[model samples]
Target chain A: GAGVSQSPSNKVTEKGKDVELRCDPISGHTALYWYRQSLGQGLEFLIYFQGNSAPDKSGLPSDRFSAERTGGSVSTLTIQRTQQEDSAVYLCASSLAQLAGGNEQYFGPGTRLTVT
Target chain B: AQSVTQLDSQVPVFEEAPVELRCNYSSSVSVYLFWYVQYPNQGLQLLLKYLSGSTLVESINGFEAEFNKSQTSFHLRKPSVHISDTAEYFCAVTRNAGGTSYGKLTFGQGTILTVHP
Candidate 1:
């Protein structure tokens, strides 16, 4: 892909329902990241995946928020028992390399999830 | 702990007027600084970055920012604003903590730039 791509550009669900967001990063990129943006707020770091090493899940807000990246290409973010507070835009980004000094992440369109 | 702050949540300027969006970070370690812009309903796009070079960096679209180490600030500035530039701007930082920090980046609260005609 020329740039990162996300699925279900917008998702509206009931309070107790579960919602899944997907991200397809640029091919051959070695690093993937997940972030959430509340309405009129800044980007909140969620998780990060680099190659096949252990993912950094320190940013997951709660136990209900979880994500996984498969084969180091595609990633999914799942929210179990979504709450009204979960309504926000979920973004995914990937970088060509994992090094901190030379990595500029490319972001996807983002999935706007609204829990009614 | 590293945190970035955009002091002004919203900035409004007339088209062709000068504008500046302030960003400051608190960190005990050296970090990389970045600026990203987001149009309405669009994803964030990188504007420019400060890794290692001259204290000032310029973007292709007439936007520039200067990295101030002592003040811990990376403020973005534009001499002339365009209506098309009305969007949200974010400041981010990436710290190099060796093994613990690989590709993770922290961002500020973002400033909404509204360029009125």
Candidate 2:
């Protein structure tokens, strides 16, 4: 089975421009997650979606960041007016579901976003 | 809230040598611990985890981690490592608050493991 996949392996954008990163979860995966890997912050959870429930947007750093999962399989993270701080690798992951203890998450190669 | 600390930012060792990457976490609530490794030009992969019962867990690749409740640590260790073990290692934790927290992982500042031939 194919692991998770992300689009535009690398993206260089001008500051203040908008960029959209896409993620395709594994087939039949019910839980999806977005995380940001930055040199200063390490890895931080950005957002999560599970089935038809409301997406958890708590980890989103600012209003400029938002994500949506459509039809329970694909997700898109949008950053409006990107800043230099937003330059990092955005990783996507998926799991079967949130089990009692925890579920192993399969990660994608990630899209490296560089804001100039 | 939970926080993780990976004591060593980088570790360099010769092939077939023993190595240890220390990780400590703080949380008021019970949590699950995990070790993830990212090879160069690759995505993160689960190395191992400790959820309950046993305090020690091992990965197929000879890496092992011990969950020390009193010490609040989940340090990863390898008796003998291969050059292929070179990669960035992350220790993460999530609250055991069941489905409410959605298993949001709080990661440590990763440790870059460099194995020299």
Candidate 3:
């Protein structure tokens, strides 16, 4: 089975420009996650979506960061008016569900976003 | 709220020698523990996990972690290491019971394991 996949392995954009990173979770995966890895923060959880709607979005750093999942598979993370600080590797992961006992997330090769 | 504490930010060891990466989490409740390895320029990969049944879990690559409830720790250990083991290792935990939390992974600062030959 194919693991999670992300688009535009590397993205370089001007500051203040909006960028959208896409993620394709494994087929039949019911849950998707978006995370950011920065030099300062290490690895931070951005959001989690079950099917379509996100349940916990507290990890989103600011209003400029937003994400959505559609058709219960593909998820896009949008960064509006990207700042220099927004330059980081945006990672996506998926799993069957967020269950406690036996569910493990499968990660995708992160999309490295560089705001120039 | 839950948090992960990886005491050592880096661990350098000689090839073919034993190694241990310490990880401690705040919560003692029923939780899922995992160790992830991030190779250079690659996504984080699941090294191993300790969910239930066994206090000791082992990865096919000779990596193992013991779930110590009394210590609130899940330290990853490998009796022997190779240069290929050079990468960032993350310790994560989630407070999930009966399918909850959306499998949100709270990772530590990460430990850079450098195996020098």
Best prediction by DockQ: 2
- Candidate number that wins on DockQ, 1 or 2: 2
CAPRI-style docking class of model 1 based on DockQ: medium
As for lDDT, the candidate ahead, 1 or 3, is 3
**Which candidate comes out best when scored by TM-score?**
2
DockQ: the better of candidates 1 and 3: 3
Off by over 4 Å in 2: none
What RMSD, rounded to one decimal, does every model reach? 1.4, 1.0, 1.3
> lDDT by residue for model 1 over B1-117, one digit each (tens)?
789999999999999999999999998888889999999988999999998989999999999999999999999999999999999999999886655567577899989999999
Of the two candidates 1 and 2, the one with more favorable TM-score, higher being better, is 2
Query: Which candidate gets the maximum lDDT versus the true structure?
Result: 2
* Backbone clashes in model 1, listed as residue pairs: none
- Model 3, B2-113: lDDT tens digits are 7899999989999999999999998745778999999998889999998878899999999999999888899999999999999999999987567665678889999999
Docking class of 2: medium
Q: Report the C-alpha lDDT of model 3 over A1-85, residue by residue, as the tens digit.
A: 7889999899999999999999999999898889899999989999989899998898999999899988998999999999999
lDDT of 2 at A90: 99
Instruction: Give the candidate order by descending lDDT.
Output: 2, 3, 1
- From the highest TM-score down, the ranking of the candidates is 2, 3, 1
Question: Residue A82 deviation, candidate 1, in Å?
Answer: 1.1
Q: Return model 2's CA RMSD, one decimal.
A: 1.0
